[model samples]
Target: MKTLGLIGGMSAESTAVYYREINRLVRERLGGLHSAALILWSVDFAPIAAWQAKDDWDATGRALAEAARRLEAAGAEAIVICANTMHINAPQVQAATAIPLIHIADATAAALTARGVARPLLLATRYTMEKPFYRDRLAALGLPSLIPDAADRDRLQAIIFDELVKGVITPDSKAAALAMIDRGRAAGADGVIFGCTEIGLLIDPAELDLPAVDTAIVHCEAAVDFALG
Candidate 1:
Protein backbone atom coordinates (compact mmCIF):
# COMPACT_ATOMS: atom_id res chain seq x y z
CA MET A 1 0.00 0.00 0.00
CA LYS A 2 1.15 3.56 -0.69
CA THR A 3 1.41 6.12 2.11
CA LEU A 4 -1.24 8.78 2.64
CA GLY A 5 -0.41 12.14 4.20
CA LEU A 6 -3.22 14.30 5.51
CA ILE A 7 -3.06 18.10 5.76
CA GLY A 8 -5.70 18.32 8.41
CA GLY A 9 -7.30 19.98 11.43
CA MET A 10 -8.51 23.13 9.84
CA SER A 11 -11.19 21.94 12.27
CA ALA A 12 -10.29 18.52 13.60
CA GLU A 13 -13.93 17.53 13.27
CA SER A 14 -13.74 16.47 9.64
CA THR A 15 -10.16 15.28 9.98
CA ALA A 16 -11.31 12.58 12.41
CA VAL A 17 -13.97 11.48 9.95
CA TYR A 18 -11.37 11.15 7.20
CA TYR A 19 -9.11 9.09 9.43
CA ARG A 20 -11.89 6.74 10.51
CA GLU A 21 -13.19 6.28 6.96
CA ILE A 22 -9.74 5.41 5.58
CA ASN A 23 -9.16 2.84 8.29
CA ARG A 24 -12.60 1.31 7.89
CA LEU A 25 -12.21 1.10 4.14
CA VAL A 26 -8.77 -0.44 4.40
CA ARG A 27 -9.84 -2.86 7.09
CA GLU A 28 -12.85 -3.91 5.08
CA ARG A 29 -10.79 -4.18 1.91
CA LEU A 30 -7.76 -5.82 3.42
CA GLY A 31 -9.41 -7.50 6.45
CA GLY A 32 -7.64 -5.87 9.40
CA LEU A 33 -4.13 -6.47 8.15
CA HIS A 34 -2.35 -3.52 9.78
CA SER A 35 -4.85 -1.02 8.31
CA ALA A 36 -3.69 1.87 6.12
CA ALA A 37 -0.21 3.38 5.82
CA LEU A 38 -1.22 6.82 7.00
CA ILE A 39 0.58 9.94 8.28
CA LEU A 40 -1.44 12.85 9.58
CA TRP A 41 -0.33 16.43 10.25
CA SER A 42 -3.10 17.79 12.44
CA VAL A 43 -2.42 21.53 12.54
CA ASP A 44 -4.11 24.02 14.83
CA PHE A 45 -7.08 25.36 12.95
CA ALA A 46 -7.46 28.46 15.10
CA PRO A 47 -4.93 30.57 13.20
CA ILE A 48 -6.21 29.59 9.79
CA ALA A 49 -9.81 30.04 10.88
CA ALA A 50 -9.04 33.52 12.15
CA TRP A 51 -7.49 34.46 8.80
CA GLN A 52 -10.46 32.91 6.99
CA ALA A 53 -12.92 34.86 9.11
CA LYS A 54 -11.12 37.90 7.73
CA ASP A 55 -10.61 36.50 4.19
CA ASP A 56 -6.84 36.33 4.56
CA TRP A 57 -5.99 33.78 1.92
CA ASP A 58 -2.38 34.86 1.51
CA ALA A 59 -1.52 33.98 5.06
CA THR A 60 -3.43 30.74 5.00
CA GLY A 61 -1.86 29.74 1.72
CA ARG A 62 1.64 30.30 3.04
CA ALA A 63 0.94 28.36 6.19
CA LEU A 64 -0.63 25.46 4.31
CA ALA A 65 2.21 25.32 1.80
CA GLU A 66 4.65 25.06 4.64
CA ALA A 67 2.57 22.24 6.10
CA ALA A 68 2.67 20.36 2.82
CA ARG A 69 6.44 20.66 2.58
CA ARG A 70 6.78 19.33 6.11
CA LEU A 71 4.55 16.37 5.31
CA GLU A 72 6.54 15.55 2.19
CA ALA A 73 9.78 15.62 4.15
CA ALA A 74 8.16 13.21 6.58
CA GLY A 75 7.83 10.56 3.86
CA ALA A 76 4.24 11.05 2.69
CA GLU A 77 3.73 9.53 -0.75
CA ALA A 78 0.93 11.94 -1.57
CA ILE A 79 -1.14 14.48 0.36
CA VAL A 80 -4.74 15.55 0.86
CA ILE A 81 -6.13 18.52 2.73
CA CYS A 82 -8.74 17.42 5.25
CA ALA A 83 -10.96 20.44 4.75
CA ASN A 84 -12.57 21.62 1.53
CA THR A 85 -12.32 25.36 2.08
CA MET A 86 -8.60 25.14 2.79
CA HIS A 87 -8.22 23.74 -0.69
CA ILE A 88 -8.23 27.31 -1.92
CA ASN A 89 -4.48 26.92 -1.49
CA ALA A 90 -4.26 23.52 -3.15
CA PRO A 91 -1.98 24.71 -5.89
CA GLN A 92 0.48 26.18 -3.44
CA VAL A 93 0.40 23.04 -1.35
CA GLN A 94 1.00 20.90 -4.38
CA ALA A 95 3.89 23.09 -5.44
CA ALA A 96 5.43 22.67 -2.01
CA THR A 97 5.69 18.92 -2.47
CA ALA A 98 6.81 16.72 -5.35
CA ILE A 99 4.16 14.21 -4.22
CA PRO A 100 0.60 14.52 -5.46
CA LEU A 101 -2.10 16.50 -3.72
CA ILE A 102 -5.38 14.66 -4.18
CA HIS A 103 -7.88 17.44 -4.70
CA ILE A 104 -11.31 17.16 -3.08
CA ALA A 105 -12.88 18.78 -6.11
CA ASP A 106 -11.29 16.13 -8.34
CA ALA A 107 -12.68 13.37 -6.18
CA THR A 108 -16.14 14.96 -6.10
CA ALA A 109 -16.24 15.64 -9.82
CA ALA A 110 -15.21 12.06 -10.54
CA ALA A 111 -18.04 10.75 -8.37
CA LEU A 112 -20.54 13.08 -10.03
CA THR A 113 -19.35 11.97 -13.45
CA ALA A 114 -19.58 8.31 -12.50
CA ARG A 115 -23.18 8.94 -11.45
CA GLY A 116 -23.73 10.76 -14.78
CA VAL A 117 -24.79 13.95 -13.06
CA ALA A 118 -24.55 16.94 -15.35
CA ARG A 119 -25.66 19.51 -12.80
CA PRO A 120 -25.85 19.85 -9.01
CA LEU A 121 -26.34 22.28 -6.16
CA LEU A 122 -23.43 23.29 -3.95
CA LEU A 123 -23.60 23.99 -0.23
CA ALA A 124 -20.51 25.10 1.61
CA THR A 125 -18.87 27.90 3.60
CA ARG A 126 -19.76 31.31 2.17
CA TYR A 127 -16.17 31.58 0.99
CA THR A 128 -16.33 28.26 -0.80
CA MET A 129 -19.75 28.84 -2.37
CA GLU A 130 -19.32 32.43 -3.51
CA LYS A 131 -15.77 31.83 -4.65
CA PRO A 132 -15.14 30.89 -8.26
CA PHE A 133 -12.41 28.32 -7.60
CA TYR A 134 -14.76 25.73 -6.09
CA ARG A 135 -17.63 26.04 -8.56
CA ASP A 136 -15.28 26.45 -11.50
CA ARG A 137 -13.92 22.99 -10.77
CA LEU A 138 -17.37 21.43 -11.04
CA ALA A 139 -18.07 23.47 -14.15
CA ALA A 140 -14.82 22.22 -15.67
CA LEU A 141 -16.26 18.75 -15.39
CA GLY A 142 -19.45 19.89 -17.21
CA LEU A 143 -21.55 20.13 -14.09
CA PRO A 144 -23.79 23.12 -13.43
CA SER A 145 -23.52 24.54 -9.93
CA LEU A 146 -26.14 26.28 -7.80
CA ILE A 147 -25.58 28.04 -4.49
CA PRO A 148 -27.90 28.93 -1.62
CA ASP A 149 -29.30 32.42 -1.17
CA ALA A 150 -27.33 34.92 0.90
CA ALA A 151 -29.58 34.47 3.91
CA ASP A 152 -29.32 30.71 3.64
CA ARG A 153 -25.56 30.99 3.30
CA ASP A 154 -25.42 33.03 6.48
CA ARG A 155 -27.54 30.49 8.35
CA LEU A 156 -25.48 27.60 7.06
CA GLN A 157 -22.19 29.24 8.03
CA ALA A 158 -23.43 29.70 11.57
CA ILE A 159 -24.34 26.04 11.86
CA ILE A 160 -20.91 25.13 10.50
CA PHE A 161 -19.07 27.47 12.89
CA ASP A 162 -21.05 27.12 16.10
CA GLU A 163 -22.31 23.57 15.93
CA LEU A 164 -20.68 21.34 13.36
CA VAL A 165 -17.00 22.29 13.57
CA LYS A 166 -17.18 22.50 17.31
CA GLY A 167 -18.91 19.13 17.34
CA VAL A 168 -21.84 20.76 19.09
CA ILE A 169 -24.65 19.29 17.06
CA THR A 170 -28.15 20.33 18.07
CA PRO A 171 -31.75 19.71 17.06
CA ASP A 172 -32.37 23.31 16.00
CA SER A 173 -29.36 23.36 13.65
CA LYS A 174 -30.49 20.13 12.01
CA ALA A 175 -33.95 21.57 11.34
CA ALA A 176 -32.53 24.78 9.93
CA ALA A 177 -30.15 22.87 7.63
CA LEU A 178 -33.05 20.75 6.39
CA ALA A 179 -34.84 23.94 5.50
CA MET A 180 -31.81 24.98 3.44
CA ILE A 181 -32.06 21.63 1.65
CA ASP A 182 -35.62 22.55 0.76
CA ARG A 183 -34.52 25.85 -0.69
CA GLY A 184 -31.77 24.17 -2.74
CA ARG A 185 -34.25 21.68 -4.16
CA ALA A 186 -36.47 24.58 -5.20
CA ALA A 187 -33.53 26.29 -6.90
CA GLY A 188 -33.48 23.59 -9.63
CA ALA A 189 -30.72 21.60 -8.09
CA ASP A 190 -30.40 18.05 -9.45
CA GLY A 191 -28.76 17.20 -6.13
CA VAL A 192 -27.04 19.03 -3.31
CA ILE A 193 -23.32 18.93 -2.67
CA PHE A 194 -22.81 19.19 1.08
CA GLY A 195 -19.58 21.01 0.31
CA CYS A 196 -18.59 21.73 3.83
CA THR A 197 -17.31 18.63 5.58
CA GLU A 198 -18.88 19.74 8.82
CA ILE A 199 -22.26 20.31 7.14
CA GLY A 200 -22.41 16.55 6.76
CA LEU A 201 -22.71 16.58 10.55
CA LEU A 202 -26.15 18.16 10.20
CA ILE A 203 -27.53 16.57 7.01
CA ASP A 204 -27.31 13.40 4.94
CA PRO A 205 -28.73 11.94 1.70
CA ALA A 206 -31.99 10.59 3.15
CA GLU A 207 -32.96 13.81 4.93
CA LEU A 208 -34.21 15.40 1.74
CA ASP A 209 -35.74 14.40 -1.55
CA LEU A 210 -32.70 15.67 -3.47
CA PRO A 211 -29.73 13.37 -3.76
CA ALA A 212 -26.85 14.50 -1.52
CA VAL A 213 -23.12 13.99 -1.88
CA ASP A 214 -20.85 14.25 1.14
CA THR A 215 -17.54 15.73 -0.02
CA ALA A 216 -15.58 14.45 2.96
CA ILE A 217 -16.72 10.88 2.43
CA VAL A 218 -16.09 11.17 -1.29
CA HIS A 219 -12.63 12.64 -0.66
CA CYS A 220 -11.73 9.97 1.86
CA GLU A 221 -12.82 7.24 -0.50
CA ALA A 222 -10.57 8.70 -3.15
CA ALA A 223 -7.60 8.90 -0.80
CA VAL A 224 -8.19 5.32 0.30
CA ASP A 225 -8.33 4.17 -3.30
CA PHE A 226 -5.04 5.96 -4.01
CA ALA A 227 -3.43 4.52 -0.91
CA LEU A 228 -4.60 0.97 -1.63
CA GLY A 229 -2.69 1.39 -4.90
Candidate 2:
Protein backbone atom coordinates (compact mmCIF):
# COMPACT_ATOMS: atom_id res chain seq x y z
CA MET A 1 0.00 0.00 0.00
CA LYS A 2 1.12 3.54 -0.78
CA THR A 3 1.60 5.89 2.10
CA LEU A 4 -1.13 8.53 2.20
CA GLY A 5 -0.06 12.00 3.24
CA LEU A 6 -2.72 14.11 4.93
CA ILE A 7 -2.44 17.88 5.38
CA GLY A 8 -5.21 18.50 7.87
CA GLY A 9 -6.26 20.41 11.00
CA MET A 10 -7.78 23.34 9.21
CA SER A 11 -10.02 22.79 12.27
CA ALA A 12 -9.05 19.56 13.95
CA GLU A 13 -12.66 18.39 14.06
CA SER A 14 -12.91 17.54 10.39
CA THR A 15 -9.34 16.34 10.23
CA ALA A 16 -10.15 13.77 12.87
CA VAL A 17 -13.07 12.63 10.77
CA TYR A 18 -10.87 12.23 7.70
CA TYR A 19 -8.33 10.19 9.65
CA ARG A 20 -10.99 7.99 11.22
CA GLU A 21 -12.85 7.44 7.96
CA ILE A 22 -9.72 6.61 5.98
CA ASN A 23 -8.56 4.05 8.51
CA ARG A 24 -12.04 2.65 8.87
CA LEU A 25 -12.34 2.23 5.10
CA VAL A 26 -9.00 0.47 4.86
CA ARG A 27 -9.81 -1.85 7.75
CA GLU A 28 -13.24 -2.71 6.37
CA ARG A 29 -11.98 -3.27 2.84
CA LEU A 30 -8.87 -5.34 3.53
CA GLY A 31 -10.29 -6.99 6.67
CA GLY A 32 -8.46 -8.38 9.75
CA LEU A 33 -5.47 -6.25 10.79
CA HIS A 34 -5.17 -4.38 7.49
CA SER A 35 -5.19 -0.58 7.69
CA ALA A 36 -3.98 2.42 5.75
CA ALA A 37 -0.28 3.31 5.77
CA LEU A 38 -0.42 7.04 6.26
CA ILE A 39 1.31 10.16 7.54
CA LEU A 40 -0.41 13.31 8.81
CA TRP A 41 0.75 16.93 9.20
CA SER A 42 -1.93 18.63 11.24
CA VAL A 43 -1.66 22.45 11.23
CA ASP A 44 -2.85 25.01 13.70
CA PHE A 45 -6.05 26.47 12.39
CA ALA A 46 -5.65 29.77 14.21
CA PRO A 47 -2.93 31.12 11.94
CA ILE A 48 -4.52 29.64 8.87
CA ALA A 49 -7.86 31.14 9.84
CA ALA A 50 -6.23 34.54 10.36
CA TRP A 51 -4.64 34.36 6.93
CA GLN A 52 -7.96 33.45 5.42
CA ALA A 53 -9.72 36.31 7.19
CA LYS A 54 -7.19 38.77 5.77
CA ASP A 55 -7.42 37.25 2.29
CA ASP A 56 -3.79 36.20 2.46
CA TRP A 57 -3.94 33.18 0.21
CA ASP A 58 -0.30 33.46 -0.75
CA ALA A 59 0.70 32.80 2.83
CA THR A 60 -1.81 30.01 3.11
CA GLY A 61 -0.48 28.44 -0.03
CA ARG A 62 3.10 28.68 1.20
CA ALA A 63 2.25 27.09 4.51
CA LEU A 64 0.38 24.20 2.89
CA ALA A 65 3.10 23.75 0.31
CA GLU A 66 5.65 23.45 3.06
CA ALA A 67 3.48 20.89 4.79
CA ALA A 68 3.15 18.89 1.58
CA ARG A 69 6.91 18.94 1.03
CA ARG A 70 7.53 17.68 4.54
CA LEU A 71 5.06 14.84 4.05
CA GLU A 72 6.58 13.89 0.72
CA ALA A 73 10.05 13.88 2.29
CA ALA A 74 8.71 11.60 5.00
CA GLY A 75 7.72 8.95 2.39
CA ALA A 76 4.12 9.89 1.62
CA GLU A 77 3.07 8.65 -1.79
CA ALA A 78 -0.02 10.92 -2.11
CA ILE A 79 -1.34 14.07 -0.50
CA VAL A 80 -4.79 14.84 0.87
CA ILE A 81 -5.67 18.37 2.02
CA CYS A 82 -8.65 17.17 4.08
CA ALA A 83 -10.50 20.45 3.91
CA ASN A 84 -12.77 21.80 1.18
CA THR A 85 -12.01 25.51 1.48
CA MET A 86 -8.23 24.98 1.70
CA HIS A 87 -8.44 23.39 -1.74
CA ILE A 88 -7.93 26.88 -3.09
CA ASN A 89 -4.25 26.21 -2.42
CA ALA A 90 -4.32 22.68 -3.79
CA PRO A 91 -2.27 23.62 -6.82
CA GLN A 92 0.50 24.95 -4.65
CA VAL A 93 0.45 21.86 -2.46
CA GLN A 94 0.54 19.60 -5.48
CA ALA A 95 3.40 21.57 -6.99
CA ALA A 96 5.42 21.18 -3.84
CA THR A 97 5.44 17.41 -4.12
CA ALA A 98 5.91 14.88 -6.89
CA ILE A 99 3.04 12.81 -5.46
CA PRO A 100 -0.59 13.49 -6.31
CA LEU A 101 -2.81 15.72 -4.19
CA ILE A 102 -6.18 14.04 -3.96
CA HIS A 103 -8.54 16.98 -4.30
CA ILE A 104 -11.77 16.98 -2.27
CA ALA A 105 -13.77 19.00 -4.79
CA ASP A 106 -12.69 16.90 -7.76
CA ALA A 107 -13.60 13.70 -5.93
CA THR A 108 -16.98 15.10 -4.90
CA ALA A 109 -17.71 16.33 -8.42
CA ALA A 110 -16.91 12.94 -9.88
CA ALA A 111 -19.20 11.23 -7.38
CA LEU A 112 -22.01 13.66 -8.15
CA THR A 113 -21.58 13.14 -11.88
CA ALA A 114 -21.62 9.35 -11.48
CA ARG A 115 -24.87 9.69 -9.54
CA GLY A 116 -26.38 11.80 -12.40
CA VAL A 117 -26.66 14.91 -10.29
CA ALA A 118 -26.49 17.90 -12.60
CA ARG A 119 -27.30 20.54 -10.03
CA PRO A 120 -26.08 20.40 -6.43
CA LEU A 121 -26.30 22.89 -3.62
CA LEU A 122 -22.92 23.56 -1.96
CA LEU A 123 -22.76 24.14 1.77
CA ALA A 124 -19.39 25.39 2.97
CA THR A 125 -17.40 28.26 4.42
CA ARG A 126 -17.95 31.74 2.96
CA TYR A 127 -14.67 31.60 1.06
CA THR A 128 -15.46 28.33 -0.64
CA MET A 129 -18.99 29.46 -1.55
CA GLU A 130 -17.88 32.83 -2.98
CA LYS A 131 -14.66 31.67 -4.59
CA PRO A 132 -14.45 30.55 -8.20
CA PHE A 133 -12.08 27.66 -7.42
CA TYR A 134 -14.76 25.24 -6.22
CA ARG A 135 -17.63 26.31 -8.47
CA ASP A 136 -15.39 26.20 -11.51
CA ARG A 137 -14.38 22.63 -10.65
CA LEU A 138 -18.02 21.53 -10.58
CA ALA A 139 -18.78 23.41 -13.78
CA ALA A 140 -15.91 21.61 -15.45
CA LEU A 141 -17.61 18.37 -14.46
CA GLY A 142 -20.88 19.53 -16.12
CA LEU A 143 -22.44 20.16 -12.74
CA PRO A 144 -23.74 23.61 -11.91
CA SER A 145 -23.56 24.78 -8.31
CA LEU A 146 -26.00 26.59 -6.03
CA ILE A 147 -25.23 28.40 -2.77
CA PRO A 148 -27.28 30.06 -0.08
CA ASP A 149 -28.17 33.74 -0.18
CA ALA A 150 -26.03 36.33 1.63
CA ALA A 151 -27.95 36.07 4.93
CA ASP A 152 -28.02 32.31 4.87
CA ARG A 153 -24.42 32.15 3.76
CA ASP A 154 -23.36 34.23 6.73
CA ARG A 155 -25.36 32.05 9.06
CA LEU A 156 -23.83 28.88 7.64
CA GLN A 157 -20.29 30.24 7.83
CA ALA A 158 -20.86 31.28 11.41
CA ILE A 159 -22.09 27.87 12.39
CA ILE A 160 -19.12 26.18 10.77
CA PHE A 161 -16.39 28.33 12.29
CA ASP A 162 -18.02 29.28 15.57
CA GLU A 163 -19.70 25.98 16.35
CA LEU A 164 -18.83 23.04 14.10
CA VAL A 165 -15.08 23.58 14.17
CA LYS A 166 -15.24 23.68 17.93
CA GLY A 167 -17.13 20.38 18.06
CA VAL A 168 -20.29 22.02 19.24
CA ILE A 169 -23.36 20.58 17.57
CA THR A 170 -26.71 22.18 18.26
CA PRO A 171 -30.20 21.22 17.11
CA ASP A 172 -30.91 24.83 16.16
CA SER A 173 -27.97 24.92 13.76
CA LYS A 174 -29.06 21.66 12.15
CA ALA A 175 -32.58 23.04 11.66
CA ALA A 176 -31.18 26.22 10.11
CA ALA A 177 -28.97 24.19 7.75
CA LEU A 178 -31.92 22.00 6.77
CA ALA A 179 -33.91 25.14 5.98
CA MET A 180 -31.13 26.33 3.70
CA ILE A 181 -31.08 22.94 1.99
CA ASP A 182 -34.83 23.21 1.43
CA ARG A 183 -34.36 26.64 -0.12
CA GLY A 184 -31.71 25.22 -2.42
CA ARG A 185 -34.05 22.43 -3.43
CA ALA A 186 -36.70 24.99 -4.21
CA ALA A 187 -34.16 26.77 -6.39
CA GLY A 188 -33.68 23.64 -8.54
CA ALA A 189 -30.86 21.89 -6.72
CA ASP A 190 -31.41 18.16 -7.14
CA GLY A 191 -28.69 17.19 -4.68
CA VAL A 192 -26.53 18.60 -1.90
CA ILE A 193 -22.74 18.78 -1.49
CA PHE A 194 -21.43 18.93 2.04
CA GLY A 195 -18.52 21.02 0.78
CA CYS A 196 -17.13 21.68 4.21
CA THR A 197 -15.57 18.61 5.82
CA GLU A 198 -17.17 19.45 9.16
CA ILE A 199 -20.69 19.47 7.68
CA GLY A 200 -21.03 15.69 7.72
CA LEU A 201 -20.58 15.82 11.48
CA LEU A 202 -23.66 18.00 11.76
CA ILE A 203 -26.05 16.74 9.08
CA ASP A 204 -26.85 13.18 8.06
CA PRO A 205 -27.50 12.60 4.38
CA ALA A 206 -29.95 9.81 5.15
CA GLU A 207 -32.35 12.32 6.68
CA LEU A 208 -32.38 14.62 3.67
CA ASP A 209 -34.83 14.09 0.82
CA LEU A 210 -32.23 14.95 -1.84
CA PRO A 211 -29.12 12.95 -2.48
CA ALA A 212 -26.09 14.28 -0.63
CA VAL A 213 -22.37 13.96 -1.23
CA ASP A 214 -20.05 14.05 1.73
CA THR A 215 -16.74 15.35 0.41
CA ALA A 216 -14.68 13.88 3.23
CA ILE A 217 -16.05 10.43 2.50
CA VAL A 218 -15.53 10.76 -1.24
CA HIS A 219 -12.05 12.13 -0.78
CA CYS A 220 -11.09 9.35 1.63
CA GLU A 221 -12.49 6.70 -0.68
CA ALA A 222 -10.43 8.08 -3.52
CA ALA A 223 -7.32 7.99 -1.33
CA VAL A 224 -8.03 4.41 -0.33
CA ASP A 225 -8.42 3.39 -3.96
CA PHE A 226 -5.16 5.08 -4.84
CA ALA A 227 -3.34 3.61 -1.87
CA LEU A 228 -4.50 0.03 -2.40
CA GLY A 229 -3.91 0.08 -6.12
What TM-score, over all chains together, does every model reach? 0.96, 0.99
Q: Tell how far residue 7 is off in model 1, in angstroms.
A: 0.8
Q: Look at candidate 2 and tell me the lDDT of residue 107.
A: 92
Q: What is the lDDT of residue 227 in candidate 2?
A: 95
lDDT of 2 at 93: 93
The sequence of per-residue lDDT tens digits that candidate 1 reaches over residues 1-229 is: 9989998896899899999998889998888576888899988888998999999999999999998888888899999999889989998898888999999998888877776666778888989999888999889878879888899899888888877889998998888878777776777777778899887877777666766788999999999889987
lDDT of 2 at 100: 91
lDDT of 2: 0.94
User: Tens digits of per-residue lDDT for model 2 on 1-229?
Assistant: 9999999998899899888999999999999998889999999999999999999999999999999999999999999998999999998998898999888887998899887788999999999999999999889879989999999999999999999999999999999999999999999999999999999999999899898999989999999999998
Candidate 1 Cα misplacement greater than 4 A, ranges: none
